[model samples]
Target: MSPVPPSNGPPPIDAATSPATPTISHPKPNGEGEPADASLPDNYVTYQLSRQTPLPPITWGNWYKELNLLHFAVLGLTPLLGIIGAFTVSLRWETAVWSVIYYFMTAVGITAGYHRLWAHRSYNASKPLQYFLSILGAGAVQGSIRWWARGHRAHHRYTDTDLDPYSAHRGLLWSHIGWMVFKPRRNPGVADISDLSKNEIVRWQHRHYLQLVVLMGYIFPTVVAGLGWGDWKGGYVYAGLLRLFFVHQSTFCVNSLAHYLGDAPFDDKHTPRDHLITALCTVGEGYHNFHHQFPMDYRNAIKWYQYDPTKWTIWVTSKLGLSSHLKVFPDNEVRKGQLTMQLKNLREVQEKLSWPSDNSHLPVISWESYLQQAQSRPLICIAGFIHDVEDFLDQHPGGRHLLTKYIGRDATTAFFGGVYEHSNAAHNLLSMKRVGVLHGGAPHGLEDKAIPPSQRLRIARYNEMSGSGYSSGALSDGDGFMA
Candidate 1:
């Protein structure tokens, strides 16, 4: 149960020695963009690096050289014990219930205690409650609160970088359990844990972690079953070893499966995601994207329907006077994060689909020029825009003759509702054929009738409406043609 520490690494910035005053700038915890009130304590700690300089790149030495054999051996033995016990030991209903109950206790020790309480300072707990969680966490056999919180803090600060102790970018195995089994050649990025170092309970637990692990992790479970129902063997197998195995793997999935499987609704900049299965496995730590974005928020699954027993436990404890000052990131900021990601996804989809030519790029054609071009090409003016419908003649669902009738004429009224009201799909398709804009708006009177060759007064009206007329000589240049 006493997992070994890394054999070699650089000295971390002593959390106890970090500056007492917060120097790192951040949004006010009130989330209102207002000045901080000195009366209220900050919801989150400002992690500071002892050295201001950027961290050096990790030096990955030979894998075998970095292997933490003792740590690996301890982890490797638990599953074996569970496997052996499963076959040889018969299960008792009492032991099975105890194992399930114990599984939740230890899982909460990591989620509600190690993660939300200490690692992120998402809430405050009473002395007795802290001790209870500390004991339960030790029983989980993950690590001491100080050690576990330190690594988790580093994971958040240097996520996806080499400095991250268990960067998901390294692969699921590396993030889940590989980081524990194999020691890194270089130290993980320094995370300020001055607050953790100052906690009396944390210090006490660290000093007696191994003893607590043995007592609560193994002996206590066996003793409980033995005394309660004379099921000592079943307790040792299911409640002790098998429960530990389940807790270990389920917690590990938060770093591995949670990151890889779900959608990133809050922010896709990080690897964290959200999924129901991951929530069920981790006792409600599955909403990772939101957790990463608003790490100070006490709740992981913010929605009431979401299964976050850990959040529920914290809330219940607060009501019972065991915990208080539960931090929640503002609703406005949470919505902004969700909207930002939605817009980003929409932009990605927009890029994949074809769009019409920009209006700014289309040519301005006088009515005279429109008529000149319509004689040779199937040009039609619709809603002030000139469309070349030569290609669309055969594709027009109504019939080729119907479109041909509008050639060299303004069909704005018909396109709107005169013949048939076009759908969004139809409008989009028509926009693709827009070769130019009519210098003046569509002619209301000229839509149905053709001007006679000798109607000089009507031609003058066309010139007046267009602001300028394009004659044969002006057609080549000095006109709004698509040159």
Candidate 2:
């Protein structure tokens, strides 16, 4: 149906209408040349036009409504009935165990595999992992990965806007689960999954979505039950129906609780937020705020102790050579970004405070100075090292050439021991990593050109070329120490 336009009202008041105006009058001689009498203010003019109110939004049609009714019956009534029947009819113990296992497996598949890996591209996985996750997601009776990813992307893009396919703003019930019950019959432009649709695997899955769901969900459970308990009914009731119920509700929480209640640490433009409770239930997907903030980072919880089982699984799989390219934000960069945000927030809070004396009550200067000092200190130190190295190399021809040999190496220790051993230089070298001098491909001083150990010894000799007879042969090439 077409959308209704809003009603128009009177012209809005503007700056021009602020001042009052005086009345004017004019008079003329009698012969058909009479002027009008004084007139009242122009504000006295009034015009009103009635406009039709827009009709209400269309509710679900009969067919669609029936479909919703059917869904509710299956999801609600069947599960309840099954539970009651299990107790009343004395269902086998094996059935209950199968059901619990299936429920957990399928739930993990959707939350960890489909949503985290495929939809979000949070991490990479091998073919085996992919197939396992895909099959498990299908077992939840949800659509193919392609369809799920497409809808999810749309959800992220539009969020709470009217264009959002399922916005929580549309009402909790509608956004939580009503969308699936009453499917949008109208083609919403073939879904914006052009990339996914192009893939042969995705296309095949999309076409056979229902078949796969039924097979994996119903038939597979039955087969498992038959194999384990020698009864197909055991698997159907336990693994099939029970599993479906749990998985559906858990997955739906991402749509409901994930957006409705959580702490948003990142961009507030979208509804995504982090909810510990939700994350626990969804198997590490609870850090919605952080996930949305850095969607490219495969690990949702940046910290090792963030309680992210999915991340752990990915890590283990990667170690086992099953997954690759697990994207992660560098620690330094993450720390810097977070620090910047913290400073911004602190500044904003200070700005909002109602200060009484000259707006100088806020203790911002000290804190800002500290942060500046911290950020600048390291940079300055590195810069100074580069500068000193360049200058020393330029002044002493042999010194520069020798230093180039150990360029990629940490000459700090060698230099301190050989030249400034009796001085405080040894103390400075204490903290550096204990790799060979030529550890990282000839440190900053040495470029691609390879230099032998002999050349490096020669450079050390030039550096110890003290003019005031401070020392000579203070350097050494292994045995013949020059002192």
Number of the top candidate by lDDT? 1
Residue pair clashes in candidate 1: none
Cα lDDT tens digits for candidate 2, 397-471: 345565555443334445535544323322222212111111122234423112212222222234546632211
- What's the true lDDT of residue 38 in model 1? 31
- TM-scores, all candidates, are 0.79, 0.56
Model 1, span 332-378: residue lDDT tens: 88999998888778767666766554445667688888888889889
* TM-score top scorer: 1
The TM-score obtained by model 1 is 0.79
Listed per candidate, the RMSD to the true structure in angstroms reads 14.2, 24.0
RMSD (CA, angstroms), candidate 1: 14.2
Candidate 2 has an lDDT of 0.57
